[model samples]
Target: MSLSRQTTSRRRFLQGTAAAGAAAFVAPAANRAFALQSPNERPVFATIGLRNQGWGITNKSFKFADFAALADVDSNVLGANVEKAAAKQKKKPDAYKDYREILDRKDIDAVMIATPDHWHTKISVEAMYAGKDVYCEKPLTLTIAEGKLIEKVVKETGRVFQVGTMQRTESGQRFLQAIALVKAGRIGTVKKVTCGIGGMVASPVIPVAEVPKEIDWDFWLGPAPKVDYRALPEMRQGYGGGVPLYSNCHYSFRNWHEYSGGKLTDWGAHHVDIACWALGASDTGPSKITPLEYSLPVEYKDGNPVVHDQYNTATSFKIRVDMPNDVEMIINSAGDNGILFEGTEGRFFVNRGKIVGAPVEALKENPLPEGAIEEVYGGPVSENHTANFIDAMKSRKQPISDVWSHNRMLEICHLSNIAMRLDRELKWDPAKREIVGDDQANSFLSREDRKGYEINM
Candidate 1:
């Protein structure tokens, strides 16, 4: 069957089974498959950040395990998601405003954290320290130093951390087949890779406004320098309040630097990660990043074009990355948003919906060896990515997107932003994890946190 049809069929099956009651149908099969020592074996899960991507992650992960709790800063969004998860699991789950409360629960086995970028490292490291496994969303960290710190905590605690770069699981026929061909030398000595990530334009500035009563703006701005809540419009919009407010929570946070890493990090977390994976550099990354050119938007905050004001990230740029082994890759937001692998023999391009090759029919039929890509997985053929996480939780095995590899890939995305911001070429020592020669660029590796809300690691 086609991929979409197969996915639809699986969803229908799940819906039917859920409607018939999980105890009467789903639990028996799962118990038999797992060979439970006791009749009441269910993995208890909790979710932090209950809206947007967090809701989907919770619902999906809970399908294979028991959801024990839901936590979020906003009660409106949190209560709705808690109700939905309760109905799905056929039981009420504990709810909390602070994620620390969920981590304190001894009964919870793991947590799925989908908070904003700034909160990822703080909550993820704390969860590991508290003896619970973590599944955090992509980009993994707001700063390069944060990624290293989280990596250290995971090692110290021996906790299983699955970064939510689910594309590793969903590449399907096109991307999988393409990667296999590249690895098998069908592409010959691969010398260069082209990764395309788009940019964001500048946003018109507005005056600061009042903070919402529902939001603990202080806690929301945790670990970041204290800016009046009015500086954040996107978070204000998320509370059902309209725009034009200074501190709105809504759709535009991805463009700002304080809350997100812009397109370079957003799409870079997805596409550049694939580049790192296909090149077999998941455990390491590029050693040199040079910002070739950038189109700066016209806006002023304090004499510097405020790329962080509303949307201060580069809107158009190209960067060249020098990896180990003489491999040079170019990342740009100028072309289509996908990856192009150019080798000595032939080239292959893969994107969200399509994969194309110089030899056209190679991707359609007569693809790579049947078992080559699956060999990388070494697991049962399952469509549910969240199920893979729960299984890993029980087995104590690394999930498909393990922390070490995902963090290494994320370094490339983070550094790319730093290079663009500094507008210079940087020599990086990957082994030492430091920027060589440039003290200013190195300073961008970590941010100044607010006094009372710093990440103590």
Candidate 2:
């Protein structure tokens, strides 16, 4: 049968009552059965953390499969999402404050996790243990240790995991074609890669106020140190809130040390992952990180700038990381958020929707190495980011951004943060997964979980 005809047949079969049984019987051989099943036989997925980017991921997944449930700590966000999903799916979904409730249901074949960075490890590891595949948001973990832990669970459980670094799946022909060229060696020997990522600083702190009746403050604060809930008025800074609740929920989580690794991990999760991919260093990372310079943002406590927050994280900074084979990656906090690849033949730069070259027209004439980038990027090119997760779930194959690779890239982001914190150059042993010669810096690689929240190996 033709590909389109097979897709249609799968869709029809998936919509019927026997869809689950059909999927169970056919998924083991999904690639082979691709031509036989209707396109409707898509898998079912549940979404945890329904605020901010979580909402966008849900909409993307709906085109491929039924959105089985929505879970979140905030009732305000949860109820609104449930209604929206009901309208879209034509059925009210199960809603719960505790993600464990959703994980208990066998009907949920997979989960899309966009929780706070701290919670990413816990929820994802648990989901995999629960026999569910995961599509987790970027930065993957709150710390280097957690990244390694999640990587372990994923390997052992054999569950498919796709880090939500959607840039890997973006469709802009220029950027896609540029990365293709870099991998193809059109840029020649990659001597350096510079990534620029920064935006407005954290908002001034406000006093702690009553927790919204619609939100569960304790659950939202999951695993992080307890702090007074700040009632700062929401700022209008674009992508999610300019600041997250407790200064860690919204866009501002990039600024705090407790819940995130600031921009080092926030934007690093996106750009750095791509850089590593283009360099074919997904399984490894830079051998050394030196914080050339830094300027931290002012700290705020109870709506006032305190000395403590003066430089919680480096707001303006530059770090030079030494990759294998004498390749050096210079990352700077400047310009809009994007990456620039400086190669021997020429230099190529790419941000969200734009790609430009030093010679300007090199991109138009230089073709990618025959089957280079495509070989590394396995599977359908058109699958929406979330759809890739579902495809991996059924096929039990690694998605474009797997846990092992993402964790390796995350180490670069984590080490940068550590180097800035210590104000010193750091030596790293990737095989040992430790910072060499510095006990204090090495200690920062992991954190002590509050009692029951500790990650168990």
Candidate 3:
């Protein structure tokens, strides 16, 4: 992480980004539409949602950009982050509970939105509209429609958007190496890829509790439909968790369908995204999704789960997806949690920690060319994901984890969850981006946003 020298003033930062936005959409990623300030002259940034990932990213953010302001609906977390930011350097950022206020600031060149899955798309779209570049955490959207909305926004605004699928720039480059090997035909014609992303567990019915005083409960539940506020265990920094209560607040939001698609989006957002990249199908999606076996925590009617008090996502499941070009893929709970890529010649498994298999073991004797892995990354390896985003901002280039491809990968995860919820097989047309002959299933492509929080392209 680079230390800030307080080089560029707030006023100059706003002027550069505003001038850049005027001609942003007119240029390509390879073209420089703005005159980027030098590394010594830091670009201004404001981080929204100072939770775990957001907190960690904010720490790394100072390396590349200035922290002009910080925002989170939780006032407790907001103040803590402001103190942490001030401790790192002399800059004292204004703090706010509403993230929109931070986005409204013209001096903010970019914002890292680490909000819950439900809020990712909305904040990202608004941030882009505010002429601020966005670095949003993964499972970038809650539904296919939201992905499309974000896609339209990114293309229209040409903002530097980087999804927090950081494995693409991990130190070992294990994922990139695996993708490179697959693309280089080191593994013969691709046969089938298995992504072992486990399902969510069933949580006992959680009783509603009074909202915390330090948090703005309404703002936190922005696009998600109204639900009773439940008290949750605070997640301590070093210790694992604060308590074992199961309710849709903070970290546990990942386990509920109302807020997120459970682990299908949690871990799936990472591995499945990598699986699609390896298959060279990032621009397209699966044509058919078959739920082989699944167990839900509750019963359902008309696709909405009947029991809402308990966790409703699938607790146990396996899904088979048929991608374009006859490639077979499975997202399930059967194996170790990682992506397994099998080709006619060799097979390998990769995750955030490691990439290993018979083909990889063979590398001890016959290694892949040095150029192969770098080619997968599109160039040399980056210092970190945040660095890549900042570099992209400077060069006006697309980051490794670009939006269109990530959204296409997310389509598969969303379809997998739909098939699991319905417990059936469904055919899809990636070209049309819809379920074929199944209106009910097609409707699952998007969800009804709360009255005031609809997303429009």
Candidate 4:
């Protein structure tokens, strides 16, 4: 049962394929359970960013995949997670500071990416070309243009790609049921949806500090601007602890425009994705994104944040999106931290904890059609998001949370951030995937990667 017991024949098979510059063995669809049979049967995996969510997805996948390598710019994080993974799987994996080392290894069948928002596209696109399927965390890209590149690479390489929007598969299946309810017409004619993604708090000016010796600061800032490493003395608590709470690195990166798009892309990537899915707008996108009201933590000129030492993303925002079928979507940083679907027939409120209201309540008397949830999901839902990814790997098909749909929904989040940063409404040509007639706003679509760190392919 142990990986150390893997047969020599399997190693030679992988090595032979690698030497020939071909892909590793593809598991058949019958291996959907992912239960280990022989030692060589499990899919080989490597994780590129071993932070909070990075460790999270990998840790949950021990039963289904054999992790051969782990990579991260932070030595401290990489070493700790390697030990944790070894403890779970009983096979210590090789660790590296450079993610490219993982990509170069021909044996790694798939890579789980949990880098900051800016690094997702580069790592993902490269991984696909390197003959590895990718399961990247969302929001998948920092900009709409980055998303387009990912889509292009996925098409060019013909790789199985999964976006980490677990709500579509997990969260106790509440989100799945929510979508099922919409499809079943439990809430006839959805008129509007409100996604309250919570908010960020402005941080005090963080002073530049010494980069920890364990971390490679330059590598961590790959493709992003080279700036002085900044942090405060106070360490964060609870989730994403050990790093400075107000720093530009680590968990607080979500609060910076340089690395992330604030709550709009953070939680909006999750909630808005579900909202669009329910509205049958996953393939298409909004016609317009209007920042009705918002407040930012820093001043800006030409949509660029003036202050770099503090959190500059919006602290509170309410954006109105003109969705298809005249459905209005309100993404705000106020009210309950969940989604509210209002329709002519009934309304319901759903989140991680529960799905409630008249429509959900009436399911007892007038139930959804058999296989309704599965139908909404395209097939039987997996135990979790990773299970779905492994299943997709086996089937050599797209997972439930495919990249194209993720990018389409994620465009709303990115556009919301753009609208807020520039303080203007944006007319979107969804067919063209551009901001209409706004040169200044369109300029923010893609950022020039820092030299020497451009994407390899």
Which candidate has the top score in lDDT? Answer: 4
Candidate 1, residues 1-457: lDDT per residue as tens digits?
0112222322333344344343432342233222132324545678998667788777766546678899888777778888888788789998899888887676776789987788899888878877777899887888888888887887887677888887777656465556677788877988999998877666666456677666777777777667765454443444434433333243455665777777877888888878887788887777899988876554544323443345566678888999877888888988888889988988878888887877435545655667787665554434556766655555556887887787787787778778776667888888888889988778878887678876544
lDDT of 2 at 173: 43
Best by TM-score: 4
Estimated TM-score per prediction? 0.85, 0.86, 0.90, 0.93
Q: Per-residue lDDT tens digits of candidate 4, residues 1-457?
A: 1123223533553454344232222332234534444455677889989999999999888877899999999989999999999999999999998888887776777899999988998998878877778999989999999999999988887788999998887787799899989877888999999999999899999999999999898988998999999999999999999988888898998998889899998899899999999999999999999999999998998899888888999999899999999999999899999999999999999998888899988989988889887788787667678878866665567998998899999999999999998999999999999999999999999999999999887
Q: How close to the true structure is residue 204 of candidate 4, measured as C-alpha lDDT?
A: 94
All candidates in order of TM-score, best leading: 4, 3, 2, 1
Better candidate by TM-score, 2 or 3: 3
lDDT of each model, Cα atoms only? 0.72, 0.73, 0.79, 0.86
**Candidate 3 — which pairs collide?**
none
Residue 95 in candidate 3 has what lDDT?
94
Where in model 2 is the C-alpha error above 4 Å?
1-40, 171-175, 234-238, 241-248, 298-311, 358-360, 363-366, 369-373, 455-457
**lDDT over C-alpha atoms for residue 444 of model 2:** 85
